[model samples]
Target: MTIGFSSRTSRVARVAVCCSAVCTLAALAVATNPEGAGLPFGTGAQDAKAGQEPPSLYRPGTQARPRAGAPRVPRDVSAVSWLVADAGTGEVLAAHNAHRKLPPASTLKALFALTVLPGLPAGLRHTVERAELAGVGAGSSLVGVKENRTYRVADLWRGVFLSSGNDAVRVLAALNGGWRATAEQMQDKARSLGARDTRVVSPDGYDAPGQVSSAYDLAVFGRAGLRNAEFAAYCSTATAKFPAGGWSYDIQNTNRLLTGAGVDRYPGLIGIKNGYTSKAGNTLIAAAKRGGRTLVVTVMRPRTGGGLAVYEEARSLLDWGFRAAGRVDAVGSLVPPRPAAAPQTGPESPPVLEEKEEVTGPGWPAAGVITGAAGLGAAAVALALRLKSGRLVRD
Candidate 1:
């Protein structure tokens, strides 16, 4: 049998066939490796991967989603996940996709600092060895540490916060034995602090498989870090001397909210951390004080290429949080650290350490933000649609 069709119908048929094929591949891709699919929580099989849940501003059981009474989030805010909480009370005031895990980029550095800062003496100095800098990921950010140059522990912390320096993280991780050890410690610390969605695979927060965190957890890190005078000081420093000598390098805080460089310096803004990678997009955790009330806001994976979008989104959330204070009931509370346990003497059990205190979305994809093969399939469908219709169709 011969199929009869007009020119327009033929073109349409071809387009439809192409779209169908692309979508099938996308579906299959998502089906095969659902976990790697980067879909937001609650949208795909990935969400069911034990311990994951849908993003919601209101705490679980307050309501399924944000009610009209909740603070109004800016329509223009582009992050896939965000949250605001009372820094002092650990109360999560408002959030969107607060529990959805995504790549953290350099923002994970905050956790690194939290895990290792207490162990290293501020005045302790170590010579930067060539091996310490080796194996840093390509295109990673740096504070220009040079081999053979000795740096104070405090200085390295400053680099981590100011320059978002991968080099600084590497050196410090080495001081703790190695990056792997530091990452393990960071993960352990994250669990103890109630950051349920964090998995620290890289000490420097470089993009790595399974290295993920949620907005809620990032805020937890900020709040926990602020308890440490040193963590707070390092993050808040607007500028720091990289090497204290003639070859001194001035590194500025990458957090525009504090610096007011590419964006308006947020009033009452305090130190925290921000991060980005092609995979992670833009992420930020910001803290500010107003009328004795301290609020920490975290935004992750905001739309890329919009200058200052992350800070702007954070500012919006902070404003909403302050306005909603005493008005909106908290959906959840950031759990306080586990109390220090007395030393245990057993081959199987290690001694517990004391705790230090500190300060501190969007939508689901239809196929649930499929990543890896699923992401490629989605890309194929999008590309085909764009080519055929000359209009962008985002998944």
Candidate 2:
């Protein structure tokens, strides 16, 4: 199907190109750090295999199939794409066009949270700086945090998850560095999580050029985010308060599911995120829990049908997921796999790491060490790495 890809085509193309480069540089950084990609995380084959398989696969005429005359799987949105999963098991219950890339709008924050969640310092207070207000066109839902404002790192996350506050996201991004650096890091995290259809061009999920992700990728992020008790608690909130200048601004969650509107007008609604733009119409990531079962749903570019089109799609998907596999005890094994003896566990002569003498992108890469640059820089690095291994380009 032909998407109405706008003239911002250059921006989107540049994002893909840049991310390729960032991936290359990130690989180099890890290699140079001597830690490789195996820092605290175990580098064993078993650890790598975890979360790599479908949570559950149904066999025809098995107990896993829905009962006779149970609801059929939902239809895929025409312009939109989606995936539904059993969150507890990380098993994809149903998916349509799961690999297709599309604008994510504010839903990009789902990933923004994932990148920062691991690093949030316990009980650390961060002062919001004036320079953090750098991005243009932050929307109306700001915390009204002033220049030189102070807030707890925890509160900043609350603002981001609950209010979808662009200003809060900006402050967090600025604290990390500029959006350019933070976005590069975000893409790296998304890659590490195996989100093949995602790229971040903005710290907050603004309708910026080249900031796009697929429904499948969003589902992955939403599931991951829910695992964070803090984020889950934040999203579940219907209202939040941030006070300044002797007054408190009461911010409400934009997710209708939390508001008991639209498809949430049904039952068992939990929380996630919502997004929209001229390019990306009424996108949503939603989840529901009933009888100890959790399901995540994402939809993008819903046909201009109506307001709750995306929510309706989500509800149907959620219902199907519960029926497809009713309350599996586990998505992944809770017990750790038995350890296998390493060929040589004592770091006996670290594996010889290879470095290419030259690097290039689609165009030529200037002969230099991979530096963290945005857009084209990232793409160039990915391309150079590909060339070093003599492998054809693959997304």
For all candidates in order, the CA lDDT equals 0.78, 0.67
lDDT of 1 by residue, 68-171 (tens): 67665566677888888899999877677777889999989989988998889989989989999998999999888888988999888888899998988889
| Candidate 2: stretches off by over 4 Å | 1-70, 76-79, 138-141, 261-266, 326-395
lDDT of 2: 0.67
What lDDT score goes with residue 325 in model 2?
A: 68
* Best of the candidates, TM-score: 1
lDDT measured at residue 119 in model 2 versus the true structure, 0 to 100: 72
Model 1 lDDT, residue 148, Cα: 92
Residue-level lDDT of model 2, residues 1-395, one tens digit each, is 74343345445555667676666676466444432234235444333333343323211111123455655665554544776778787766556666567889888888898887667663677776667776647344665667776677767776787777788888777777767888998999787766756888876777877778987688888888888887787767777777564667777777876776544453777688887767778888898898898888888877856877777777777777777665332332212234445544456754432454333322123333344344446566555545444475447
